[model samples]
Target: MILSVQNYGQNKSIAKDKIKVLENTAQESIFVHYNSSLFMVGEYMYYKIYCLNSETNKLSHISKIAYLELVDKEGERVFKQKIRLDNGFGQGDFFLPVDTRSGNYKLVAYTKWMSNWGQEIFFSDDVIILNPYSNNQRDFLESEVSKEDLQSKSDLRPSNSALSELNKSPLQLFISKKNYGKRDEVIMEFEGINSKKIPDGEYSISVRKYSPVFPNQKKTTVDHLESKEISPPTFDNNITLPELRGELVTGRVVAKSTDIPLENLKIAFSVPGEDYQLKIARTDVLGQFHANITKPYRSEEILIQLIDDNVDGLTIELDDFASPFNSDKVKFESFRLNPEMNDLILKRSIQNQIENAYFKVKPDTITSNVNELNFYGTKGITYLLDDYTRFPTIKETVLEILDNVWLTENKNDKYVFNLRTLNGEFNNSEFTSLLIVDGLFVKDQDYFINNFSSNSIEQINIVKEYYRMGSQIFDGIIDIKTFDQNYAALASKNDMTALKLNRQTEIKNYFRQSYGNESSKDLERIPDLRQQLLWLPNFEIDDTQRITFFTSDLKGDFEISIEGFTHTGKPVSILDTITVE
Candidate 1:
């Protein structure tokens, strides 16, 4: 009996150790409030993502980027976006293609650092999208049958009248009318308790179709909320915003004989076949090291080696920390359109097709900002390729047609282009010239010389003086322009590292129209096929706020749902329905 008591105490001690391990590790959670649950083809699905620390339920400062994906039933990713998070908040939009199949889709969100755990912890939600142009009669029939079954089951369930009488939330929702007509204006009012005590609450108001098949699915939403509630507080209280560290690979090192953490261990990452610049990092106090590689390597595998000269009894453990969001608790709702709504959808689909065709033919009318060009304040010597029509090879074209440049061979039997100074001396000690083709870096000199043809070269610009940009310094720069924008396509066939240039996220302005005090004739002339009547992503409830939006030409029941978090981190959802005849 004494031995049994001792074993019980030992088991308790082991359990406590396991709990401590979990407490030390940092975890992240993501929450998103999308405009609507249902969408039509050619429409945009707008959403705002909120990333929080799992332990404190506050905005996470550990991850600066969030990934959003739209996956189909067959586990295929239809669309993906890498959103930049500022203070753990990001907003983006996904355009539903017209050819998309009608079915239940998933919207998943997560961060790169959060991937260290399993993907099951990622936030996921269901979105029902319908393509009126898709001619899948079998799918439509199945969807209709499912909707009928759900409506029947819902009718059999007991009424909420008794439950409503027992408890009431502090929030109240009101609408000007219970019914509306197509292109009619809808006014809404929301009231709550004292604003001072509650603090102004932020909310997302969306008007989507009401369907029993999609009835209040509680899997991802509830699990994400519950996990935040249960996560223990972190040991550290200092909140620091995460920096944009590129392609982080983190791991720990320890001594094999003594089982002691090895601090300041040097780790190096290099490409096996290519002459890539080695990336090095050092282990911290906890024997943990994170390597941030700024460029992308084309090799399939990278060799990671311990740079320490004396590696007698050291052991290294390397693993990937990519965890994706899970949708285990996600459920789909079915929506069936009435005859009137179906007719309107058909008309809208045709209208969208016509608009798309028109834009394709007159694309020049849609201009982009010229200030977004990357080549600014750059003045270099330019040589037109057309001036060298008789050259047989690119090397011949460069040497015969261009001046102050010559070719030299290295010890590895590889040809290297050397940039000559005005004094006719080779400027090639430790400094290397920068080679760029169509705004992309050319890492392999041999690949560039052999692949680029003389005819394909449109122009070449040379900057002989030392050029400095950010942390990089080049002895000189050689910029090659191709006749066609096919530099990436040509470079893809080689083993050179091609780094993608970062571009600003395109800002999209949603289409909005109003017909205030206009005649019916004027309204009929314009195409009124908007599936989303009103989308208010940022809604505050400090005082009574009135929202006004005119409905489209679609006649159906539009459900208004307000979902948000209170100042105290409590989740709230309010629902109401309006009919437009």
Candidate 2:
């Protein structure tokens, strides 16, 4: 029996002879909560991710990892990081470089499983980063007339009364003081209507300079000023939906001559540049298959080769899918900087320079030796290379100085090295012996033996018995310690991949200044240029959850916005503004 599944909203039919697969497959989505949409250079962008099953609106456990990419305006990846998700939740931070240009960037997030649907399902948001010291300047002022004529128009200055009117909101928000000085403490409180206790929900508060539009400003011209309020997720009145996933690649295989469906055919997905391990997928009864790549491809195209033995007259059809999420639908209120805000920006910029300088002088120390204290609870035979005389080559030292090691010339005139037990029993097993240099895996022996010098060796460790690491079982282990941690660089020249075994994310403590109990003399010595005065990612609103944070050395109106979802998936948003003079 022939079964044809019609493509949704398309004239073509897919999986002509296979069962309906689309209806049986589940849909997944990604939701990310970022600390702020706008950032300054030299600052860290922190975010929390939540992966959910769209149909059930519950957290998904299918994907254990998520790929986060920061892309520039020209579609170039600024940075990419793989985040390990736990129970559908993950958190990560990206540090913005000081040399980054002042422009709009994007934060894209998706999981490997989500890629099967298509890139249209990936979650993406626009992020604006400003670098005051950047040579490339983005004009904030727009006009058809000359700069002098534009400045001459008196209506350019927004009235101070309008600024006060925009500060009001329906959500009950309270401040400890109406005005604050530079580096002063700002306390805030939030409650439901009629002073009732606020319900449990997720929230994000953003404080930024308020930008006001002048009367002379044209509506058609795009303003460079950032939005003061945080961008909240779109909801259907109260129901919150799941986030979109990443790009998806889908295709079908059919017999070229008879145009018949080719079922159970294995296809390989790989990039041609490097020998990346091929990802394999099998066609279903209808000759349809799909694969999800968590991140966008660095190259414009990818190669898909059939793995079947007989491929004389077989054809593959690729499809271009549309993105499911529309960024334009998410709206945010526009804000223009007034005189007071402009003054605050100038002072904050100066303080930022001081902080950056301080960090440079006292940089964070990162430890290079990850396995210093832990050595798999086993200490094998150790040979200190420094104690013995240096040999002309590593092969000579291995053959002469080392015991239970064999070096023999192969038929190709190349040398083959093997490790044996003290009893002269050759350590022969199904899997090759594990070779490591400076805690990095050594995949190729020629790359290690030829490039690595005997003089640069620090020590050698050998394990004669079989070793087991997770699912990998090695016949034995040969650990080579280097004098310096530069073995990876030297080995990379021989067309080999040398990767750091440690995958732990480095912990960074952000610099925070305190003046509450400090002496007056100490206050004068410190410069405060903190644009983001307070950032609390996981804030709970229990009885003891009193929000208190000190303001930075700037004078202007600081906005407080709280956004999150309730236990029942109801979206909530609260806004309030406080002035600091």
Query: TM-score, each model?
Result: 0.57, 0.56
- Output the TM-score of candidate 2: 0.56
Per-residue lDDT of candidate 1, residues 111-184 (tens digit): 76455454566677767677876776344456445545656533321237622421133455668788988778
- Looking at model 1, residue 301 earns an lDDT score of 42
Candidate that scores best on lDDT: 1
lDDT of each: 0.58, 0.53
Highest-TM-score candidate: 1
Positional deviation of residue 207's Cα in model 1 after best superposition, in angstroms: 2.5
How large is the C-alpha RMSD of every model relative to the true structure? Answer: 11.4, 11.0
Q: What range of 10 consecutive residues in model 2 has the weakest lDDT sum?
A: 219-228
lDDT for predicted candidate 1 compared with the true structure: 0.58
**CA RMSD (A), model 1:** 11.4
Please list the residue runs of candidate 2 whose C-alpha ends up more than 4 Å from where it truly belongs after superposition: 1-26, 35-46, 55-60, 64-107, 126-181, 185-414, 421-432, 439-451, 467-474, 492-507, 516-524, 537-548, 560-581
